[model samples]
Target: MGAARTSDRRRRRAVPWVVLGLWIAVLALTSPFASKLADVQRDRAVDYLPASADSTQVAKIQDRLPGGETTQMVVVYHRDAGLTEADKATAADQIAEIAGSHRLTGEPVGVPSKDGTTLMYPVASNEPGIDEKARDELVNDVRDVARGGDGLNVEVGGEGALATDAAEVYNSLDGPLLYTTVAVVALLLIIIYRSPFLWLVPLFVAGVANYLSMGVAYGLNQWFGTSVSGQSSGIMTILVFGAGTDYALLLVARYREELRRIERPYEAMVAALKGCGPAVLASSGTVAAGLLCLLAADLNSSRGMGPLGTVGVLCALVAMLTLLPAVLVLLGRRVFWPLIPRYGSTPKARRSLFAAMGSSAGRRPRTVLVGGALLLGALALGTLNLPGAIKQEDSFTSKPDAVAAMETLGRAYPERSTQPITVITPADRAETTLADIRGTQGVDSAEQGRTGGGWAEISVIAKDAPQSAGETTTIEDLRDKLDGSYVGGPSAEQIDLKDTNARDRLIVVPIVLVSVLLILIALLRSVVAPLILVAAVVAVWGAALGIGGLVFGPVFGYEGTDPGLGLLSFVFLVALGVDYGIFLMHRMREESLNGAEPVTAALTALRTTGGVIASAGLVLAATFAVLTNMPMVQLVELGFVIAVGVLLDTFLVRTYLVTSASVALRRKVWWPGALSKEPADPVPPKEPERVTAAAH
Candidate 1:
């Protein structure tokens, strides 16, 4: 029986390499097809366009209309007396010259402020264009011209310049951030494992998962005509490396433990897989489900992120289960060459801290449960004052183009720098047309132009700046009133204007919450379990937001929260927190079926799992902390909040909650079946004895 069992273990251990090879082949063959697939979709989408709806027709109509290329850049020229009419005219001329020279297809119109203190040049893009590279060149060229020999302190600000600057900031930080994160994680892993080869193992596996996931994401973009932006790229890197390393740690840690039990290396590998496979699968399933829930999001960008992130996680899981095990099998015992521990013939016995804690919790269930609840409740208090703001101006680093543009606008034409509100009134309605729109509340100025045969475009500049949510609300109310009061237009006639800020917030919140909830339920396999998990997740999210608001709002003078923060917080909390829950629950389940009693089982599980969970949490937290080195405010906030949340989940929630729950339920913890009502213990298999050769 022993020989047969050993043979069976060897076969199982060899299977993963075969699977890894197959996956590698699939990734290779699929990579080249990504570009081809994208081309096919692009061609089909282009061909299906209406004949009258060509790009030229759209461009011509937009240029001739008031709100066609309604967005503008504000150029702030500061001097002792602000700007005289002569100075304004010269600035305008200089701007126009630069625009013309640089092939800037925009209507450069300069208007001095009503106070006559600042000059504002509102340049509208003729092509409705905002290209990062082109905009950067235009801004730089304009800056050079405006500042040269004029002795005029002039600054150019607008969406184009701001976006270009933000991109530059990101580009500057990307290489350093990537290297730093990789280096930090590598060093941390080495410290924990105390093995150079083991450190490389996780890094190598994560790299494969990262690259393959990127290839898969490219394929997804090709198939769906989705744009994968820089944000998504950063997220892809974090997810693939952080999550991949996590799974590797779990598997390798178990492999080492199993090695201390079995003599043969192959037997140990198979034993480790059998023990760790289910836990890894559950953890991966939760993460994948959470990310996949992004599909339900209203925003195209976020919806794209769902599948992109999910692919990375799934790839990591596949690599951990297949490639990682295969590598271990091939390396055999040499993988841990220098650090092999001396072992006796008998299995060693040692009391684990997690086991002690679990035992205590099982003995005193109320204490553990109540204590945990109180801690979470206290943390959740910060959430009550949670503020949700999506300020694009604040999303990037302080040095980003967007921030510079906003600052320039605030200094120059604060009113005009604000985005214009487009009010669509039916042309057929004489009472609600351009003339009527000019008379509406808060309208500083109104420009009307024909959009089509029956639709009139009314562009209204607000009395106040448009960055605030209050401004957004005012615009929304104006639209509602216009639509409801104007009955003389076509029944289908409606207002369609983009609220970039509000649209971002609305799309991010539900998508993140729903995605996280789905992932929790999939992992826990109980409806109640997911609900509680999500509640904890929400608490963590709220805490993160509150902390961010306080730090950014008060310390940095950032007035409001960046919308991207909410979405990022959601993903990070879910991914990292779920890992904690998975680690704890895995051990909890194992103990419930193996330990002598419910209390003993809880104690044993905690002792065994607590150390690993803590180690994994520290690694993940440190990995996220690397984001602090990024130039972007969003990344910094995301890194800090996620790191904090991981620490909380790992040390406080996972340790206490699982222990308390195990004790409270006792035998009933298993529920409906009680795990067969057998005493929790590992039943040793009978060993076969060989017959004596002399007697035979």
Candidate 2:
């Protein structure tokens, strides 16, 4: 019988190895597709536009036209004081060289400012058409040919150049962002664990999860026609690391506690999983569900982000819960070398930071609650300081050549727009649309550009520079006048984006709230507790944005807020904020179930879980903060707000305010639940044999 039992134990040990082997095979199968994700990412304005928008329609129509999507550029030659004869000759020679080398749509037309300090050649081509690579090459070739000397400055800018520049920035982000995030997470893990071997486990697992997520994201794009953009894909990486590490922290903490009690590593892991698996599952589920709510968004980029983000969270959760546990069980106590959790050994008791915080909150819960509320409210008022919508030229932290050219155009040609407002009309009604476009209030010039496939493309130049208020009005007037014609360009795309995002906020916000609240209610088995969590996260969202308002313009020098910043940040913060809440509340409920008084349960929960929550928050916040170092201003803004919000939620809201509220409310914090009912008779609480350091 003993021999048979030994054989059964040997077979059980092989199970995890088999599971790991399967995971390895799956990753191997998915790796090639993952590498191709960058090739499929589309960042064109039209790609992000709402389907029903005229710009989106225009893009489709244009693609069917002779030129497909036109590649436009402005080659600017500037001599600030005044263009010398030599400079003019140099500019003329470069423009002529460019026109000679490439297929010229029209003779390179020179537009000189009144002061003669700057001269710009308007170059448009359809040779590259809709191929982004071809378009970028054309722009690069043009820049290569256009050279400057004798104090003459030359820059290439326009829609195509802007797109090329943006792509370059995106391409650069994947490597630096991934490395920085891994380093940050590794360093933080080393600090948190204080062990040479332990930190690498979760970090390595997160890296694997990221690799798998990339493969799955690529598959979604190829199989289901899901749109992927740099922004969405970058955020997916962040989620994989941020959320994945958080789950690892909680699991390892619980595993350590169980290691001190259970004889075998596998048994200890099993016990730890049973104790904390539900909370981790629910936390990740809440994040996934909230992200999935983005599918209801009208904007294509926002809508596509839903599936990618969900895949990332779910992938991370699976890797952390399964692979992490398997690896830990296999490695056993040696995984925590130098601080090994020996069987039956206990950690020396000490006054924890959370204990002191909870003790103070317990003393004057109402005052702490009121003070925290007032502080968040005051910070929210900073929203009034936020700047207007960010202009295209202002969307980069460091101005690229294209943006520099546009800025020069803005200054030298303030009276006329450099970019065209594209109008795609049915060939049958082309004449009528042309008449209306010409008659538009701010129109400077209108001309037919390309015609084919029952459609005609007309380029309209506005009196005001691109993205200016007057130019926006002109496009709107053109759209209002021409019934079937589509008005689209960079400026119009912005308008559509802003409108779509606002509409999405209205649609998506409620869905996220309801979905997350329902999930919380189900997990906690109580109404009041879920409501408190929801309300707390909402407040954190506002305070975070308000804090952004205070810093973005006056402090960080950002010109405008991203149109989707508020909505996207809210979704991320609320979902992630509630994550820590779930940990704390779950532990509180556990203690309460074990017969601890309400106040003691809340305080005890804080004392034990506080350090883990803080560490997770730091990891998440640091991972997101990586975005601020990227080149794009929109990304920087989004990263700043989300990173700041996580810190606030982690340190202040989750740690103090929630604790205060719980202390103030007592059993009422869990009203409408069986646990809320006062115990018939008081029972002494059992002494904690192990530190409840895992995320609740």
Candidate 3:
């Protein structure tokens, strides 16, 4: 027995070093792949669009055309007071210079606006083809040569230029997003722990987990040809820090409590794992299941996000459960410094914020429940104010050069569209398609441009502004008029993106709700409890989106909303919000099993787990809040909604509504489970017989 105990202690001492060594090896292997994740990320509209969408088909067919893919640009030269003789001469000279430099599809034709204030030179180049770097360089060269002076304004505007500008914003997100998220998490941890050294452990572990998730993401992309974009990768990074830190907080809090009871750090960590492991596992599993529900979506980005998000969460889970415990055990109790939990020493007793909250909730369960529901319902009403799908020019928080040019075109050409709608038809029917497109109701002008790969491309201009209702009607009319032809362009892509998102919301939201509810039911073994949690998270999601609706346009000055915002935010909020609910309900269930009354168990659970849940929620919310400071409006809106939802869930729903509901429901909260039934009265233990001094 003595040898067994000594051997166990030795093994425990050796385990930390082994874990550290293994992690170092894993990091070394994964670092290369992590570094390469950026190379495979695709951010084109086609990359995000549904595979069967007409716009997606057009884009794919264009790539197989004569020159692979053309880089089209329109050089807009405008003067508010109309072009003078010298202004025309200057425009002519610049047009000649551009034409001489690049291989344009046709001669530079300057289309003067009816008001004579704007002159746009239609320029198309097959030189750069499908090479993104080359395309951006070409656009930059055109912008450099097409500069204006005095009253004149020259702007480079086209699909190619807009893509380049958007790409810059997405590419710039990775470094700053990671740094900001790490900083926010670190600050929150320092405040929560109030211990310098203890905070670093979890932060460091989360960073490793982030790196590992990136490597794994890249592997998935390479192996399965999974679509990855700057959007999905950025969200993945947020999850790594947000969800990883959450798991760390729960583990650390439980470990601290155990340290005061158990003498050895190893034994205490084991006890901590036993205490909180099921809840952590169940929570992460719930999140992963919810994210995976996105696979049913038709949109390419949404489908790809399902796996990438799950990778981030599962990576965080593994790191928190393994690397976190190993490090904490190795560091032992002094890692907490001034607030070190000493074995056999009583902790300082004080009233906690959650305790006061639980008391109010316990005292007036029904009132609190109804009041919370009313507040959520009121907040949800703001969804009516949400802006429509964002347009290209309104996508950025700050106006980019392409957006500036597009705006100029929009103002100058109010009677006709500056952007061309592309139509691809079978090569055999090229002439018929071109004639049909020209005869279409909304057609301003139609021209045959490129023909190759068994398809012919036609550029058709509408008699209305880009993305306007009239232009949409024109595109629809053209689509109806021309059979077996794929009609597409920037506006068409936006239309497809918006429609697909709406469809995805109907499909993915239900899947996420059902999957999460089922997981909760299995974890809690109670239908009513799971229903309450699902309803609470759904309310939180609505309230969060409603907050976005109230603030996105009015307060933040955003012009429109991203098409995917509704579906993505719902998935994230419901999945993450339920994590706190799990912590609270699981603790409440444990207390009930230990023979405490339902109301007593509910209050005790709240008082015990509330602080940890609050801390975790704050960490998660803060990490997401970092996205609000990002450059793109889509990222900012997403970050804001999710952050707001987390706070509401943590402080309001989990702490108040859930506790009160449990109290009100009493044993019925655990109905169909053993705890729902009444137990027999406790029997006194038999007293031992006393021995006389003579007997001894």
Candidate 4:
């Protein structure tokens, strides 16, 4: 007996050091790859295109050409009154300097608008050769040489310039987003735990999980050809912090509860893990299963995000369940400082927000359910008000130089398009294809641009501005006229993206719903409960998007929506929103199995898990809200919609509506499940005991 006890003591002492050493080693191994993630991130339209898109084919062909993918840009010089002789000379001189400094595919051609207020030059170069840094340098170098003053405006625009500007925005987001997320989580944790030292534990663990996720993400990219975009990568970081912290909250809360009963800290932690580990695992499993369903998506960015997000949530779970417990046990109860949860200590008696809400919901369950359903249905109607597909120029919250230049072109060249539509055809048909492209309806002109690898590239300019209806007609007409050729460029890429997103929604949405439903069924072993959660999350998504629709245009001044916003947001909201539902329902199942009556079980589960769920929701929502401050409009919109949905689900739906429905339905909520058949005799209901708020 003495030897066994000594051996146990030694094992306990070694656990923390072992776990700490493992984490340090993980950090060391992941550091190099994690730091290089930014290097592999691709921001170009082609990088995001659907695999079967003509735009993707065009990009592939361009990459195989002699110059290895040309960077096309437009330099616009404008004067409202008219272009003076000096202005024309300055424009020409600037173009000359640019051509001299860089390897141009051909001589830059200056095209004067009919209004005489603008002189635009079409510049193309292959020196960048698919290298993002070189392309950005080329664009920046050309912009530096084309400076304007004295009422003359100059701006560099087009696909290459736009890509550079977007990349800058994405790169800038990496640091600020992480910093802001950390600060927010720390502050919220401090408030919830009220212990200066306790909050740091989860935050540090989450940071470790985030770092590990980044390395794994980079590996996935290198090994499996996963497409990493700014949006996908940013969301992955958010999930790591948000989801990781959520798991920590659940584990810590249960641990605190277990500590009140068990004497030894390590033994208490073991009991806590035994009690709630399955729920945490089920929640993370559902999130991973739902995210993995994104593989069915046609959008490359969305598909890649699925795996990266799964990696984040799973890593966070592992850290919280293993590393966190080890650290906490080593530190003991003193880590809580002024608010340490001592064994044999009873919590103070106070009415909790959820308990109060549950009381009201219990009294009028049907009324509350009906009202909540009506509210969600009404909010969902806002989707009809959402704007159309976003144009590339309008994708930024603040206008960059590329957008400004495009705006100038729109105003000065109102009757024509400045952006080129690239078409690739058989080299033998170059002459005839060029002629046919020029003759196509809405074509302002056509020229043979590049020829290599048995292919000829033709550039076509439409009669109307880029993204306008006239240009759309012209692009379609050209594709129809040149059936064997691939017609693509910035405009066609957008069209393909929009079409592909619609298809992905039809496919991936159902997959996500089914996948999540299956996981819930397996976890809860109840068909009715899973359906309710699914319905609730779907309603939350609709209502959240409706809120976005209501605000995105009239409040935020955005005129367009991202093509895949609906699908991506739905997947996130459904998968993540259901997290709270799982926690609540899992606790309720525990209560039922422990012989509590239906209503008692429901209210007790809510009373026990409410504070943690609320804290988790706040942290998750705040983390997502951080994205709204980003310059990219898509991130802002995505962040806003999801944050709103989570808040709605947390406070209104999860607390009031779900609780009320559970009360009204009683045991039928678990219909056909084993729990429903094994109900104990009914006990008179009483107010649920309140959990300590510090557990949050």
**Clash statistics: count for each candidate:** 12, 0, 0, 0
Tens-digit per-residue lDDT, 349-447, candidate 3: 999999999999999999999999999999999999999888988989888888999999988888899888999999999999989888888889999
Is candidate 1 or 4 superior in TM-score? Answer: 4
lDDT of 3 at 234: 94
Model 1: CA > 4 A from native: 1-27, 30-71, 80-93, 102-107, 114-117, 127-141, 148-151, 170-174, 341-363, 411-418, 423-432, 449-458, 484-557, 564-568, 676-696
CA lDDT, every prediction? 0.61, 0.90, 0.91, 0.91
RMSD (CA, angstroms), candidate 2: 2.5
Off by over 4 Å in 3: 682-696
Question: In candidate 4, where is summed lDDT lowest over 10 consecutive residues?
Answer: 687-696
The count of backbone overlaps in candidate 3 is 0
Deviation (Å) of 284 in candidate 4:
0.2
Model 1, span 1-696: residue lDDT tens: 778766776676657667777867976876775334223221111111222222222333434554343334556665556666567667877887867775433456666666666666656453333233544566676667765235555666665555556556655654676687688779988888888687887788787777677677777776676546555556767777778888888888888877666655556667788888888887877777767766655444455667877887888888887788888877777777577633323335777666666666767778877877776666656554445453556655555544654665665555542455545555576345556555656657867644554555555676766555455545554655665322111001111112222454576557666766665555444454555556666666665555655565556555445444566577668756776677766666676544456566566667777877777888778877777767666677777777777877777677777568766866565543444266445555233232221211
Most TM-score-accurate candidate: 2
Q: What TM value does model 3 have?
A: 0.97
TM-score: model 2 vs. ground truth? 0.97
